[model samples]
Target: MISQYLGIIHPLFPVPSSSVKTGFTTSISAGDKLPQIQILPLLDEVLGVHRVNNRTTHQLTVPPSADDDHAQAWEAFFPEGCINPGNKVAPMGGFGFFMKGPNDFATELGKATSTHVLFNYEVLFESEWEWRKGGKLPGIFGGAGDAAYTCTGGRQSDGKCFNLRLMWRENGKGELYAYLPLTSSNTEHLLSVPPRSIQHPDYGFSVGRGAFTFVPGRWTTIAERIKLNTIGYEDGEIEVFIDGKSVILATGLILRDSTAIESRVRGLHFQTFFGGHAPEWASPKTQRAWFTNVSGAILTDERGIHRDEL
Candidate 1:
């Protein structure tokens, strides 16, 4: 068992199909076997093939092509310490995906589709990595839904979607934030519910703070259990786990406005870049970080879905 709370699914365990639906209202019992999905293995399989994109120039690639000028980019920035050598994956010893500021960015490890929708992974920051000052902070793992999920021509449609980002603030503080689009009249810039900022007269605002503090070499496990909200109701749920413990739970939220877009997890949205989006956010010097044992699973408990860390 990699983690006590989030246990690793037995490798031999059968994976479920994307179309399989779960009873959203049923309570998951101790022994109930919910449909599961594994994402870490895909990293191993696609090492030299798949590379995803963000809204930036930097993109993730494995072995460089002959015509690739960035062929030496991997060696120059991310070196051996960032990757594991053996077949077995570990938190510290497994296959590592190294990313640096300015020229390095990771969005998705696999294709973007309405399949196997849960996202899970572990992250470790290199000592030299720099934290950004402001703007949308750098993210570890997030997702972008299909066309129906996002706004088109600046108009809100009957579609639905949400994005989750593990981010850091200016003072070097780090936390996890969930971005839920509000059903507003201005579709172009639909309002977003602030993180933990929903007002409670007695409790004050709840800032969705992360469980563990950001340490340069220590590993942090992050998992997001997402279920699209029932249209027009605050039944949508987005739960996050850090290092085997449930840290932030944002429930009774709205994930969609209409039934046109089925609430299904789309892309894993593997991101590791420095800036919010611009060149000004680029690092002054080169930086690096190591990530390993990335995974995704669909468990009834949501909190128990594990991605092995060593």
Candidate 2:
């Protein structure tokens, strides 16, 4: 079966080139500061890091050597690359850190108190990077306490947790992989873009399949905005912009049913791996990807205007 949606390309929104910089607004004055976790200047350590598939080594790392190709490319774009190893990671990665409450640098930068949040970052798969089946990419996740963990890895979300991550398929086909609170009443409206918006019985929604392609060896900017719905209403929304073009726009989502603190956007979930947890998901050989300009902000409204500006 075809897994992705190859919808008609509306003339107004053209597919973007991975190599070109589109000057998209990635940071906001009112948005909370998401510390570059790769190099934590204030905090002593990240929330946690783990490897998957019985791997012994930590899958996430900063290129320890400056001469490394990943390191060189990272330095070209951001100043931190010189001192901090760009967010480099090996295959089958798992890590989670918060942007609110006591555990995050955000506490020092002021906690993120809004229901809507936006995250921005750039990613590069090395020129020789290998695509083994498919894998996960970093995105926003949140829930009431431990509820967020239930939204991923084949876990069922009981309207308490949610996760939104990007996935890359064979040859770099990309899509928004999300675990949402899908109910019988709102399922039809949530899946507005047929074919493109796929429902995975074991997982969650595979949206915008083939909406954009990740060009190996080039940098791509991803901006995602997530808005929580009114308690008990399907007014939530999610928007993904690849290289500055809107690719996935999902509205009328029901992320939560209550107004609890843990029900709001928590923070970044840095997860990447190959799989179905079988042999095929493992990388054929060692591969690397670099990340930088990791940032986030609270939005004032659904229009995506920076809250601080108001």
Best by lDDT: 2
- Return the clash pairs for model 2, or none: 5-196, 31-297
Give me the displacement of residue 17 in model 1, in angstroms: 19
Worst-scoring 10-residue span by lDDT in model 2? 77-86
* All candidates: CA RMSD (Å): 13.0, 10.1
Q: Candidate 1 lDDT, tens digit per residue, 123-213? A: 5555655555421222222223344223211233234544455555554555554444544321212112223233222211223532345
Candidate 1 positional error at 171, Å: 4.4
- On TM-score, the candidate that comes out on top is 2
Per-residue CA lDDT of model 2 for 1-310, tens digit only, reads 2111123131111222121111121223111122221222212143322222233222334533333222322211111111111123323243233333224434432233466666666677767777767777778888876776567777777788889888888889888888877686446654664347777788777887888889877877787778788787777877777865667777777888864445767766655555545555656765666664454545444343322211
What would the TM-score be for candidate 2 when compared with the true structure?
0.68
The stretch of ten residues in a row with the least summed lDDT in candidate 1 is: 22-31
